[model samples]
Target: MGRFGKLETDVHIKASASKFHEILHKRTHRISNVSTDKVHGVDLLEGEWGEVGSIICWRYFHDGKARVTKERIEAVDKQNNSITFTVIEGDLTEKYKSFKFNIQCIPKEKGSVIHWVLEYEKLHDEIPDSHSMLQFCVEMSKDIDAHLMEGSEEPYHNDISGQKCEALSINKSKKRHVWHCLIFLGLNQNTMGRFGKLETDVHIRASASKLHEIYHERTHHISNVSTDKVHGVDLLEGKWGEVGSIICWRYFQDGKARIAKEKIEAVDKENNLITFTVIEGDLMEKYKSFKFKMQFIPKEKGSVIHWVLEYEKLHDDIPDSHTMLQLCVDVAKDIDAHLMEGSEEP
Candidate 1:
């Protein structure tokens, strides 16, 4: 009769269980395929990988001779996030009576705990302990973890778009950032009217309805003014009184006029902030492309109004859009003045 022997070790890793699982799935074969010398070629045969009932065969040099082992995945449970491998057939069958390896993962605060279980029976009573194999597994786990943490040098699909937009602090809980790129269409020079775009992150300290009221009054008051020296009526309309509303404006330039529109993109009443997006109108027609976003943030002492504009110039002579930016800043200042004066009517 063959007597079973067992060895167990637990290692706590500084990565989440999900991360550990990802590492294991991507880099387990490095542990299974081992070579004794540089001259020896070692490789693992695979079929139906990372699933129950899968099989893996390893071939490598051992004691100056070729050795092979066939392993079968006995069980796999993604919910529990565990797997077990049993040696089904191998050249070492005569030397080792039985062998089984099990790995279990548990989620922890900042990382995960990996439990390794190994069991084997030897043909001879004097057979030595497989401490080297256990050491090999532990070291390989660390290698895989390092690889995953560092990540691959090759760019991923998400990176194709470009690096993530960096965050900027506009307030304690609010952030803002900008994104600008020069495409084949033209350069993003201020003179070209194709300046950079702005994205605002805002957190407000007031209710949604109050913030909406402020946004409506401020935008309406500004649109009513003449954009250029020419006299034209720039009217704003849509779900005029509520969040998720739309506003359109017509501005006179020269003898003719142009129309632009904006849509309420996001609203958080609890946070007292509203974000609006430019969906349609004359701005898009004048520029090859144009879009903007605006956000209103209410604070305990006062509130901040954020504005972002993205546009491409239609011609090289248009000049940069600093005038538009100044217009926005002026509006913000006006609103601030009104708020400080305790006036709700703008």
Candidate 2:
């Protein structure tokens, strides 16, 4: 009953959707090479690499301990750019009755979004949820995205004994084993720290489409809709919803007035998603970088507004963006109430 649960998260990736999906769908064997710190190896045990019914064994580290999982390819939907893996054996089965993983790469107007869903039925209510595992997937995805965008074709080498070796091309006819060790030394030097991500889900009674329309097309109206939080929003360059367009927001945070100059990074109306990257703003005083993404997921009756905040602190003393996250939730709730009132009018 209550022990059965699901956890979901969306990771914003800088890589193209098609490329990211290709790695997951066709190049899964190279995953350990791209994300060497997390995944030690991925071995094909049954069937072919991207085919359904194929079984694979994943050797990796989780929660500071080495773990293994034997998973079967459940589904591969090319049209939607998604894949599903069902765990059939290994360490995960020791505590959970069942566990499944689904990953979807949604193409945006610019960069892509990686949606991860983990479903499991625990043997007992006392068994904790798979939050750490979800986080591991997220971090691993980030590493892979970084590698894809910046890595070169230079082959890395590794040995079966777990030591670094020269990269080799497998010759199946010769019965040569494929040893994948594609490592770009220092490829991720600048990507390690200061960056942060936060997500908050706010449920509402208003239609998800209507809310999305307000934020996507009629963003200037947000100030009017939530006057207490947003004083104004002005288009500084280009057109609304256009990628690379610049805009400025006058808002209240921590009971103090503030402003932020941002550039539109992506706006996918089909998926009800938008992203904003801040270039200049008062908040930039403490943050080296800041970005925001808003996505709406529809439900049977109401819907949920997913807000993601990505930022990097200029220094260690800077606090996390909890207050900014609260501001986003407050403003979204205000707009939701406004939309509901409008729907009931006349």
- How many clashes does each candidate structure show, in the order listed? 4, 4
CA lDDT of 217 in candidate 2?
Answer: 70
| Model 1 deviation from the true structure expressed as Cα RMSD, one decimal place | 24.1
Each model's lDDT:
0.50, 0.75
- Against the correct fold, how does model 2 do in TM-score? 0.50
1-346: candidate 2 lDDT, tens digit per residue: 2356566766777777778888777667778887888988877778887899988878889999988888889999999999999988778877776789999998876567788888877766556556678778878888878887785532133233222222222211111111111111111235433566766667677888888888877789899888988999999999987889999999999879999999999988888999999999898899988989988989897777888888877864565576787688779878888888865321
The list of candidate 2 runs beyond 4 A from truth reads 151-346
lDDT of 1 by residue, 51-141 (tens): 6676666454454566666667788777776788887676656455667778777786645666677777765544543544554454555
Please give the range of 10 consecutive residues that has the lowest summed lDDT in model 2.
176-185
Best by lDDT: 2
| Candidate 1: residue 126 Cα off by (Å) | 1.1
- List the candidate 1 regions with Cα displacement exceeding 4 Å: 23-47, 59-67, 91-94, 153-346
